[model samples]
Target: MKKKKMDDQHFDKTIKGRLENFEGPDFDPTALADLRYRLASITTAPWYARYRTELIVISALLFFTLFNVLWQSQVEVNREQSFIQVMDSLKTSQRIIIDLQQRLSALRRITSDSSNASSKPMTPMAEGKLNEVDNLLSQLLEEKGNNDPSVIALLGQVSEFLRSEPGMNGDQSPPATPLSLLPSATYHFPLPASSDSARISLDQVTLKENGGTAEAKEKHLTAAMARELKKHFQKGVGIRLGPAASLSAITYSPGPRVPSVGGGLMSDWILSPSLSMETGIIYAPRFYDREGSTMMELQNLPGVDESLGSLKEVDITSQVVQFPLNLKLYVPLSRRTEGVLGGGYSFLLYLRQDLEYGYQFNDDFDGRFQGLKSTYEQAKPRFYPGTLNLSAGTSTLLKNDARLEFSLYYQYGLGDSGLEQVKANSFGLRTAYWFTIR
Candidate 1:
């Protein structure tokens, strides 16, 4: 505000300075005679002279108030922008911390091998295995670039842990169970030692669609054969899902739109900001004349609402419930920010997908029509149980660490007709708040 005031004052001075700098012609024309006549005629008004000072004071006060209000608005706008920027940075920092934590956890989870020890009185092979272990230790304690002393120190601790773990020929007992669930990361030796051998394998999924055009000779799936061969070696494995998921949420595709006027109209009416309520059923049976169901949604029927106007019935209402399988990726954008993009497909319903199932259909009588006549057939929930996103957000803190965000996204239904695809744009806001990440 202080800077704004100073700027305004400087701008006013600059404007007046330019006006004062003008030098007029050194000739007096007939303009002075006309001015004299105008001055002689202006003395008739009396209210102007009495209220002149009061009007000047009032005008100055109004200007000051307007100037202050505008300045405050600008400040708020700047704060919001800065918050958004800081959010990106915070997201990036969060990603780095996560990567570091994962690395630390992997080091902690590593198991030792007692069978690899030299059984034959420390032969050349045993020496080679020891050399390999030494190399691994060097890698574990190596400095991370030039900075990040904590990460380097953590690596050193991991090296000490590895050294403490049992070696070959020591006859130490092995872990009761092996790590069979998580994917094991491998480190390259570059040049393998004389006695020790290393092998790697994938444990998760076998791909069916992962084929390059070049791999497919004359439209034949050559990559399929390659995958089949690779399965024996297990270079890349399929992923496994746990009985309990790590994260889950609800999201939808782009749905129908409501046009508004005068004030907040269509969006407020159809796409409810509040939880939707169903009155028996709100669809007409004939609307489903195309496919899938027999009975329609009933609204304002014999035992329904007193009003039969906008309240109508559908032919039938059918909902397809499904739990989604998601493939998620966290992309680091900068120092403290990250971009989240994930996609998946599933027709299996989980208990958590209740709201997602409800989201496929909606009906509002009082919410849509008020004083005007309009068409209602176009807004019915006809198709559902398609693909949808559970959560998608971009969290970032460009360089700063202060930003918060809120968003609203939804779709009325996923229609099957050709024309319905064009209506797939819905409401969502990308917002941000400000804060620092620890």
Candidate 2:
């Protein structure tokens, strides 16, 4: 029992001696207090304070989405209203043409009866009424070229009656009234002869006035209406080619700028005089530069303690294509020039990538040395697949139904570039040559 007690006391003395020789970790009391204060403040902070940046970004996106949808709906409504107005105008013009035809028919009937009863002596009152009808018919025919089918039929009937009249049997010609006095250039129907047996052919009915044929006048009017309608609607296809400059690295990283070239085919639709939409596929050849180094520990020989750290350099290059849809608002600056503001979305289509890795030792302490290098080429999946863009530009009308446009634009990537924490942003100039159809 006494020996057990002595051994326990000796163990206690050895533990105390070791404690006296040990050293505790270096620490600052003030730093500990500060850390505790910071933790407590974070716990008591509002939720919005913790996620303020995320909340702002989400709110901005929601507002932009809502505004775009409402604007498109309103534009559609306006387009419908404009179409209705044009159709109404055409209907009203058709009704007026029908009324004119009815008046022409009634005059033709009365004149035909008068010519047939010419063998009977005419009283002064009857002759006056006939003259008045002839004057009204002449005025209606001269005001405009009546191409209505009903008017043409009535004219044919009048010509037949004049040819069959009994008064035309002798050398005595018809009375010198307005209808008989019409110039050859003013009438599209054959005139009656002094003899009943005299015949007239349909080919002799063509009217020419001021060196312009009836057919020519009709064509002119049709062309005028087409031009007027084109002022309200336009559609076209265009080809665009331009130089582009872009950020070659991930967003927030130092840009290694590179030159790029692009070209595309686009379809454009003008919803109104001032609003339009465009969509197309673009083939853009893009390039990126990445220069980085990594540190790795190296052993001079197998199972040896002596070692050195090595540095590795990595470089990468890529090429891609893009598809975009855009909306544009136009403000007329002159008869042939306009200022435009636009916004849109795009999708990326990746093609190929080249990666190179090179490594070397920091110091050549050992006589033996090693150099390692590798290169790989691969087809890439769709990378940085989505982007949003904004643009401002001007367009100038050119000859032969063509236009020239110039714009400056900024694009913001909405997805990663197939790499962690990497996005894209770019600014560029675009020029397009467009052909318009209406």
**Model 2, 1-438: lDDT tens per residue?**
999999999999999999999999889899899999998888566868834543554465446445544544454334335644653543333323333333334334344545544354544544554454455455545532455343455556546644764442332223334333233322222111212111222232322333211221111123223333444343443233222223222332333555555555565666665677877666555455443422122112122222322434445555566778889898777656789899999888766655555555444567665656565566656556578979898988653335678888787888666322246777778876554433
* Top-TM-score candidate index: 2
TM-score for each predicted model, relative to the true structure:
0.21, 0.42
Please provide, for model 1 over 36-154, each residue's C-alpha lDDT reduced to its tens digit, 9 standing for 90 to 100: 98998886768777345435544554464455445444543343354345434323332333333333343334324445534334345434434544544344334223234433444
Candidate 1 residue 421 C-alpha distance from true site, Å: 78
